[model samples]
Structures are given as structure tokens and as C-alpha cells.
Target: MGDLGLFGPGSVTWKVHAEPILMVAGLRALLLQTLHPRALAGVVQNSDFRVRPWHRLETTVTYVVTVNYGTTADAEEAGRKVRYIHSRLRGVDPRTGEEFRLDDPDLLRWVHVVEQESFLDVARRSGVKLTDAEADEYYREQLRAAELVGLDPATVPSSRAEVAEYYESMQPELATTRDTVESMLFMAVPPMPFGLGWTPLRGAYTGVAALALSMLPTWARQRYGLPGLAVADPAASMAARILRAGIMPIPRRLIEGPIYKAAMARARAAGHAI
Candidate 1:
């Protein structure tokens, strides 16, 4: 799952490339939550408005799990652990700022769905190549975990159209005030500290590859003196660049604000709400 580029556009290898690093990060988060639910709860409940500590924590954990253990079974287990910890935490209501249950159904659903989507998108982008049968299997496996989180299995969308509809129906419930989904998107990519263990070599390679790819067209134009060559075969050139450069890492911040907003806008234009 970590190998999947669902996070954003990059080399397919980078998606696979970043998995182990992400997995380690996830394991760290889960271990922290398991050991210190109260501290985690406190962070979730009282962090400053600008800093969403809980969201970051969740993202870290999810990335770790997805990268380390890509199977549905692993995701389900991770979900269960999150729910368990959430059940124990006491927090102020997000909307009302009053004492509230961390295990609130709505909140749980939001978290679970966001994480699930991240993993799914990664899988899709990485060219995991899920056939309808595989998709159905994936859906069924996820359904069991969704049930644990209080989500209705029936609510899970199986087809692209259904996914669009699901996003539409949840639009009202989704926060639009501060691009909450964007936060999820950005956070889904774990920070370096958390990701260091899984694929350090791959991570380094991807970063270098991305940097090289970014400079290739200019290099080609300047060195080879081939004006418009890059433009003429942009797609092929980009592909060649990635192949030559190796895997590249995309920064999470790039995906959150503008990119996410654009996606949301497009989805909305297509009659799907985010």
C-alpha cells in the first residue's frame, strides 16, 4: 500500500519504494497510542487550532501500517487498535468544544474513511491493478473493519460512481471551513523521522531521482541544445526522466492545499461533493 502512489503523482517504484519507511512510522504511532492513550487523548483534545497534533499522529500511524503491512487484515487490525484507544480517550467536542467521547461514531468514521481512501488511492496509483473481483475482495475485507468502527457496511461504495456518490453524500458532514480533508491528505505522508526505518535507501534514491527529474528538461535543452524537444514529447520525456532518475518523493504539503482543493473542486463540478 505504501508502494502505491495514491498519495500523489510519482514513480510507481517510489510508491513501492517508500513502503518500509512508512511502515516503521506507523508502528511507532501505534505503539505510542497503545502505551499512552491519555497523552494521545490530551493532544487530540487540546492542541492549538493551527496545529492538529492528533491528525498528524493518526496519519503517522496509518502510513506505517499501510507501508509495512499492505494486506486488508493488517489494516483491519490497525483500525481496531485505533478504535480501542479512541474508546478510552475523553475529549472536548470538535464542534461544540464541550466534553465528548473520543469514540464518537462520526469522528471514527471520518478517520477510518480518510485513511482507507489514502491507502486505496496509493494502491490505485501504484498500479496494483485491482480487477473488479479483487476490488470486491478488498471491499469485503474493509467492510469487516468498517463494522468495528461503527460504519455501515452498506455505506461502502464499490464502484467509481458509488465512490463519487459517497463523497457527495458526505459533503455536508465533511468540514469545508479549513480544508480538513486537505489536512488528512498532507498528514497521510508520514514525516521523515517516522519513515526512516522502512526504506532509507529507497527514500534517498527517490529524493535524488525527483530532483534530477525536475532539472532534466532544462539540462537536456541546455546541454543538448534541443529546443522544444522536451515539449514535443512531454509525456515520454517525463517517463524517461523518471526511469533515468529513479523514484522520487513528493512532499505532503504540495498535495494538501492547492492540489486537494483542485480535486475537491473537480469532484464537485462532476456532481460529487467532498
Candidate 2:
């Protein structure tokens, strides 16, 4: 999965599904921080988002490029190849009880944009500063992939509003939530493993929680008694403990099933599914 060209040799559909995971992870990181503040101190350090890790950054940027271009192009074309083989599986749409088509451009664009915005917001809050030149470079490198997905480099939008307008134009092609989720399921899942290292899991989970908490608004931070306002740096201390322990064990069902589920449901209802 790591050796191919930027768009690989697959049908356009595969690239669509694969491109947004980076954005999803990035956005999730950002929202967790913005809504929780203290969370930032846990999972990431200052170095994780730097330009040096262009491969990692490319994944995150892909979504943004998709949103702006409806395909990979200009600044989002790097890292497009994947040679690892896996079995093909059917994708079912939960909402309509129908199968989702992998080559659907609308679905790809929607997920890409939403995920990119989410990642960008989080990266900024987490202190991953990007220079204008870096941002432009990212866009430039993505041109080839963008063409593969049917986007023209000359037509790419230059600003956020233009990007939003481009997305709105694609509404007719977008799939329902059920279809979108099915597409996402074919993508990657979290990196956590089951069993064998309970201590590391605990440390990681605790660290993630602490980082998410740190991204909350000031008032929210005060409510949690996080550092920089009321108490001495509780967030920092908790982070240190997480580092010493190696992994933080958070009950998976508790964090994912309930907490994350409830928040996402609320977000969807509020018209912010991205």
C-alpha cells in the first residue's frame, strides 16, 4: 500500500475512499481539542504535524484538496499509490439498504472536504504551523492526482468560500449517511489492538482523553480545573503520567460507543456531519 504512485492504478472510486481517512483523523484531533482543550497534551507533541513528515501531512491534506478540487490535484497529489493486497468486500448502505458505488465522485468530495477542515482546525489548535509556501506546495504536488479524479488544476478554488461553493454544487451526487458510512468502513479503523498490553492501552487512552480535554474552550477548561487558569498544570501532570505508563486504558465501549456516538449524533443533527 506504500509503493504506488499518488493515485495508484485503481478505479477512481478506491482513491476516494482512501483519501479522507487522513482528514478524518486530523479533524477528529482538532474537534477533540477545540471542544476540550486539555486533550492536546496527550496523543500529540509539537513535532507530529511538521512539514518534515510530509507523508503524514499529505494524508491530512488530501481531504482538503478534494474539497477544493473535487479530486486530487495541484497541492494534494503526493502519496497516491498503494500496492498491498486485500480481499474485496461488498459495501452496503445502511440508510437505503443498497450497495454503494466506489466510484462516486460526490461521496469522495464530501468526505474529503469535511475531513480536511477537521484536520486543519485541529492541527492549528495543536500548534502545527504551516507557512503559506508550504500550503501552496501541498496544493501544487496534488495536481496529478486531482486530474485522475476529474478535476482541472486551472479551475481549483483559491479560498475557503470558493471551496464551499464547489462542494454545494456537488450536493446532487452525494450519497446518504448509510452509503457514506459503508464507504468509510472499507477505509482504516483505529490503531488500537485488542488484549495483551492493557497498561499501554490505558496510558494511550488517558493521554488521548487529556489531549481532547485540553482543546476545549476556556470556560470548559475552567470547569475541568485544567491548567493555565485555575489549577496548576493538571493536564501536564496527567500527560507526564501517561508518558511514563506508555499506554492509557480507556474502556473502548465507554469512549467509542457512548461518548463519541452521542457527540456525533448531536453533530449530525446540527448539520455538521463533516
Candidate 3:
């Protein structure tokens, strides 16, 4: 009926991304990204995430929301800004002194792959019922997300098996750095606003963060020296499901971003049942 961004209302990407569990999925992706030394080095050198973590988080949330739920024009504009920033930023690997561009296809592809995997994995784990075929379709549909960030969609994995192979291929290149440790530690205990750390809200945040960490692969968890308890997996899933159950029913206008609202209104105006 109308433009519904890269993945429309009926698409799997929209369905998976709309869930509240993606907040944790995003954290999981961040944790996984740090396992790549080049990725960690690039971020440490280029981003101000350390000093203004909340701002960084806000910027990222806005980008994600806009790209996934905004109109095609808005999403493309967002991508242009991201690509411009990546094109201008340069950094060197702390471990090898090897220089890298933020827009490096390999780095961008790695980020895209891990991010999509995190979203899909967390959604399924949190009781979003997706069959294997639908899961693969989800990955296939997400190629547009990769393309939005300036990557050639052909370079990105388009299936679950391809994603696994991509990870396996990357394993030889992944490693830990001091920056990685600091990043993960920050994830574990990011600075709280004024007095928010003293309430049950803090524990709720911790549960989400721990759930994110628990979903990391054992090897990656071991690389970061974060405990990979066998029991944590099921517990994390339960926590995620509970959070999703509680959050998904909230009024959409209160929870969704303005761009999401606009797009949905457009779809509705076009006589779509979304």
C-alpha cells in the first residue's frame, strides 16, 4: 500500500526488530563486535563511547530506529550520513599498528552479520516463534540493511548457514584487546544517570545485560573471560521472554520512535492492515 522502509510491515526484519528484546540483542552484538581486534581498535580510536556512553547509545538507537522503520527516503538519508562519517574516520589497530578505514567492507560486513544474528537469535530465544526457513528468510531480507550501510549486499551472508561459515572464517582473525576488556566491563556496569543505580531499575538493567552476555558464543565469552555457565542460557531466555511479554503490550505510540509512527501512519493511510 505504501513504502514501509527497507523491510515492510509484513517482513520478518520489521517483526523481529520491533520486539523489546532487541535492546539486549544490540548489547550482545556490541559484545561480540569487540572480539574482533580491528573492530575494537577502530571503535576505541574513533568513537567517544567511553566518556558519553548514553549519548552514543542514543545516537545508535536513533540510527537503528530510523533505518528499520523510516520511509525509504529517510532510511537512505540516514545511510548517507553513516557512510559519510565512516568514510572520513580512520584508525589503526592497537595490536598490530595496521591502519583501517571505518568503512572497510570487511569491518562493515562483520558488523552487519553479527548484528542481524544477534537480533534473530535473541528474538527466537525470547519466544518469538520463527521456523528455520523463516529464520533464513529473515537473514535474506536483512541484506538491505547491510546495503544501507554502504556494503555490497552480495558480500553479506544471506542465510543462517552462510552466517555460520562467515563466523568460522572470521574466527582466525578475532582476538581480544585491552579496549575489548574495557568495552565489555563498561557494558557490565555502565555509568548510571544521577541516582538511578540505587533502585530495582539497576538490577533490571543488569539482568538484561547479563542476558545479552550469556548469549555470546562460548569461545567469545571465554575470550572475554566472562563466565559461560551452562545454566545461564535457559535463565537468560526466561528473563528475555518475561521482559518481552511485559513490554510488547504497551501502547505503541508511547514506546515507538517518531519515525516508526510516521511510517505506520503512512501505511495505514494507504489502506494497509499494518
Candidate 4:
């Protein structure tokens, strides 16, 4: 159970996810996921996001970090909990008046792709320097996460080109519904835990929200009433480089939590430090 769950220490997922800029990528993923009416419906109907948004965000982050760095038993237990929760949730899609299960493969695929694509997008733009082949490998590696959510790995996109094709096919189904707008607004000033002063986090989160808007797909931006103005790609890349420079220099023991520390311990035991 102490073994790396699915991705070992050298995995592309580990390499990409270790960067702090993935926080931005995560915000982007949440933004993208809310665009799907059915998926958004499931969230709105089943979760207390409207009243306790940070709880949902924290739970999602915890699950991801656990799978990425936790032991096999920990990862399996986390996935099992998620599956159990999803299995019990059913919601009616407000837009189409159609009922859908939370665990629907199509919905899961949408969530998986948006999240994986966002992680890579932020990593690349922020100066992680992954080659095209490495990026594709990262996507291929991410199929493991999709599978954890009950998706068929074979149907998941495994490369940038395939991801683009998938998005193209999904464009007709994408839109800026009221839920999307609400989610965006909520994310703008994401609820932080009490006792941690908001003043400390407000500026950083505002920048993230702005960047999420700037980096959105043109059509999505326009639908959300953003100008669809493109920020030069290098801008995000440069910002990411600055963030990496600022963060990576800190010793892991000072900045990381238990999950990352355990992963590093495993790496050390395997004869290297991650």
C-alpha cells in the first residue's frame, strides 16, 4: 500500500503537478467544467457549492493530491469514496430537462479532459519546457486518472491533437449558461478558510481569476462576455517561469504537505530525491 498508486516518482504527472502553476490550471479546469450544463447541473444539485464552495474545491484538490502522492491503499480508498458519492447522485439537466447519472462516462470524460488539458496548458505556458512528445506522454499518463473515475481509458484522448479533436467535437455542446456565470463569479473571490485572513490571499486569487479568463478558449471567452482578446502566449509562459523560479527554490520540507513528503520519502528510498 505504500507503493506509488499508479504514477511512480518519475511519472509525467508528478513532474507537471509538482509545479505551483497547476493551481492556475485547476482554476481553469473548474471554469471549463462548469460550461457543460449537465455536469454543472450535477454539481449544483448534489453539492453544497453554493453555500460552501471552498469545501468542494478542497475535497477535489485533496482527492487529486492523494491519488498523485498517496500510497496505493490511500489512493484506492479515495477513488472508492468518490465512486460511492457519484453513484448516489442523480440530477436533472436544467437546460434539456433530461435526467443524468453523476457517473456517466461522457460527463466523466469531459471532467477528465478539461482538468488534464488545463494542467498541461498551465505547465507549458508557465515555462515547464516539456517537449511535444513529453506533453503527449503526460496526456497518455493522465488516462490513468480517467480510468480511476470509471472511464474507459481507450476512449480518452492521449495526445494534444486528439484533445483538440475532442474539443472540436464538443463545441456544439458547450455554452455559457447561468451556472457557468455563477461559477466564474464565485471563483473570482474563492472562499478561503476562516482564520486565514482573506487579505493575504485576495491579490493572488484575483490574478488567477484574471488569468483564467485571459487563457480561456476564444469562443468560451466570448460567450462569457469577455473580449475574446488573446493574451500573448509568452506572457503566461513568463509568469509561470517567475512563479517556478520563486517557488522551486524553497526546500520541499518547508513548502510541501504530507502527501508530497511521503512521495519524496519513497523517491529517496528508491535512491533519489524528487
The backbone clash count of each candidate, in order, is 10, 53, 0, 1
Whole-model lDDT values for every prediction: 0.42, 0.37, 0.86, 0.82
Candidates sorted on TM-score, descending: 3, 4, 1, 2
Error of model 4, residue 124, in angstroms: 0.9
Please give, for residues 25-118, the per-residue lDDT of candidate 3 as tens digits: 8999999998988888888888888888878888988988888888889889999999999999998977678888999999999999999899
The lDDT, on a scale of 0 to 1, for candidate 1 is 0.42
Per-model TM-score, in order, reads: 0.44, 0.36, 0.94, 0.93
State each model's C-alpha RMSD to the native.
Answer: 15.9, 17.3, 1.7, 1.9
lDDT of 2 by residue, 10-96 (tens): 223222332322233453434423221111221122224332333554554544444333322332342233101101222344334
What TM-score does prediction 2 earn?
A: 0.36
C-alpha lDDT (0 to 100) for residue 5 of candidate 3: 78
Q: Can you tell me which runs of candidate 3 are displaced by over 4 Å?
A: 229-232
Between candidates 1 and 2, name the one with more favorable TM-score. Answer: 1
**Highest lDDT scorer:** 3
Scanning candidate 2 in windows of ten residues, the lowest lDDT window is 81-90
